[model samples]
Target: MATPTAVVVGVGAERGLGAALCRHFAREGYHVLVAGRTAEKIEAVARGLKDLGLSAKAVLTDATVEADVVRLFDEAMSPGFGRDPSDLVVFNAGNNRQLDFRELSAEQFEDFWRVGCFAGFLVGREAARRLVPLGRGTLIFTGASASLRGKPGYAQFAAAKAGLRMISQSMAREYGPLGLHVAHVVVDGGIDGERLLKNRPEAKAARGEDGLLGIEAIAESYWHLHKQRRSAWTQELDLRPFKESF
Candidate 1:
């Protein structure tokens, strides 16, 4: 039998969730395609995995661009050698910031939407197009707390996330019976990753042990979602630290 393959989009720092997912899937014996905007970051991730005796390759991709997304799927669906086309794919591209509604520029709002929502749509649509015909595959989207509620300075973020959530929902309902497992994962708290810790050095101390979401732990959930039985598939799952409030 041919070896399986997986594709993880939006990979960045080695310590981030996207990298964690790549590591986990590679460890599980899948040839992984690490896709992200930064050549250095994604290449480093693939090289690191290779050093650890795993199979992986880096594909430079801008998730918001349709052509880039199509090219990525082309590689994923036709990974060379004995590896089978990717049946597991993840859309984990997004950013967040708090800005006063009164001062937020239109460009800023559109930028956020382009990355946070538009990118997910492109990935989700491509996944549906490719995976639905195969009659088997898993496509997961990384969502946020903003997917469920809007806060004072998070209008743009909330709108983007909520839209992505809806896209995931629509895909699940439309394709679940056809054999595609579509899931949306709501990450509800500060991730214990480089982005948060570097920006706020005191975050780990403030949150206490396990107060922030562990990157590996979150990745484990995604793995489970992909492994779930079709008879009992999960369409949506939420992950948060024990101390995080809803």
Candidate 2:
């Protein structure tokens, strides 16, 4: 069998883990699509993949919009990738607007819901529509611990991601009969990004917060889930560093 293709949405230049996921999948010979709102960032990630002799493309998609999601799925299924709806579709795009409940505004709440749950819904539905026809595929959504428990200060982000978890389990049950696997990954660790590198040098220095679960680790878990048989399908997997407590 040829390498299965993957489409990763919600890529950001510096903050996103999606870029790393693209590199991982492409290295495995999958035709990867790096899609997000930033074209330049996506292109830069794709360029790195090309330099490494892998197939990848940069796509600009505002996942919050239905039309953009439609266009993305269309391009993903084009002849460039052997005309297939992706064997793996990952909706890793999320916007975090964490604010204390007392200080939170309606707009901030909406933003979180839109980017977290709405975007996942948009991407997941389209992936399901295409994969049902193909009769087998993997659809995974990235999640946070906040999604499972709405913390005191981060109500908005918690609610939205919680919605994604519910959606994932529901979709998993709905499509499992057709060989479509749906899994939600709860990334229960602090992500190490440039912000931590610059402002919180002490964290980088002292190895605080367990230094963010490496994107490669998360990507490998995705691959493992993808290869699982129907008899032993998993619905949710929570990932945290050794130093982090559950």
Please tell me which predicted candidate would have the highest lDDT against the true structure.
1
How close is every model to the real structure, measured as TM-score?
0.99, 0.93
Candidate 1: which stretches are off by over 4 Å? none
Clashing pairs in 1: none
lDDT of model 1 at position 104:
96
TM-score of 2: 0.93
**Tens-place lDDT digits, model 1, residues 24-60:** 9999999999999999999999999999999999999
Clash count list over all predictions? 0, 0
Error of 1 at 61 (Å): 0.3
Best by TM-score: 1
Model 2 residue 164 lDDT score: 94
Worst 10 residues of 1 by lDDT: 74-83
Which residue ranges in model 2 land beyond 4 Å of their true spot?
A: 1-3, 81-83, 195-199, 208-211
